[model samples]
Target: MGESAKTEETAALSVRALDDETWPAFARLVEANNGVWGGCWCVGFHVKLGKGRTAAENRAEKEQRVHEGRTHAALVFSDDECLGWCQFGSPEELPEVKSRRLYEKGLVTLPDWRITCFFTGKGLRGRGVANAALGGALAKIARLGGGTVEGYPEETDDRKVSGSFLHTGPMVAFENHGFTRTRPISPHRWVVTRTVAPA
Candidate 1:
């Protein structure tokens, strides 16, 4: 992609805190982007409900939690059109994620925020859309005084697998942004972090 295309795409994609008015389209984007997590609705880390839960139920539960807790996640939009999402917040804010063994090690003591899931639209894939979204998130968090940003990016040798599962983003992308692996939870899953020291 051309630098202009990247710039144009990045400009079109605005990252902002989640709100009531934007949740519907955000949900629709996730549902429509089948390869990006198969209609997850970004509820994988929010709901206590199992994978067996219906999409509608999962969606409602996630909406309820986000509304009730005031837990904010980063949202990517092109003008009024929603394109992608990245869930980030204090560990306490995402109880389901915080309570899981996958996140237990080295998590209890750190006061940090988590970047749990990401979803980008089919048309917007491989366009540096996620990097821009991440830049937006980092800027927002830094402006708010700074905090640690962490994510579990899957490791893969094949670039084809990288495109198919872009939600976790590529480890190289995170590394390019200065994130380093803190620990490896599994062969595919690794915990990476970057601390934004207070200004």
Candidate 2:
């Protein structure tokens, strides 16, 4: 079977927290999808932990962040292979992210969580991988007794932005999943939220 066929066959995949044993596969996924975020390893916001660091250094820091449980980002997987990732956690837990203009909006006065980044393997883009990842994240959040989930997606008129930089995801993706635009940080970015009522 071809790659696309293999992906389709494994579409019933699930999301899980990454641990020491799974780090290598997760790192490979980020490296393979680096084209999406310029080889970010989803460290755009976590770079503050080691400012002025080289990409290699920042990557190591991010790996340490995951291993230390200082932050939490989920990995999408088919059996044991990593296919994608979603970064989410309390914004304050990510000092670099809090310093960005993207999060300056007054929306986060309280302890709101941020879903700051996403990625899928090169051949896996536009196949609803993100939606599946979001669904898995939401379920994970719910199991944690839930809290408000927020994202800052770009408001793009043209869809040609590179995937590496498109971590915010399109507005439609959030809207489709019951998230609403709380405000627009810029013409190209929006603060979207889904408040989970106390249970």
- What's the CA error at residue 48 for candidate 1, in Å? 3.1
> How high is the CA lDDT of each candidate model?
0.69, 0.71
Give the alpha carbon lDDT tens digit for every residue of 1-199 in model 1: 7899867866666777777877777767766765235545676666565667777776676788767755566778778777776677766765565324766865645547777766678777665667766766677667767788787787786645755454666787678878999887766768889987655
- For every candidate in turn, the CA RMSD to the true structure comes to 3.0, 3.6
Candidate 2 TM-score, C-alpha based: 0.82
Task: Indicate which candidate wins on lDDT.
Answer: 2
Candidate 2: misplaced stretches above 4 Å?
Answer: 1-10, 33-36, 49-52, 98-105, 197-199
Which pairs of residues collide in candidate 2?
A: 36-163, 36-164, 37-164
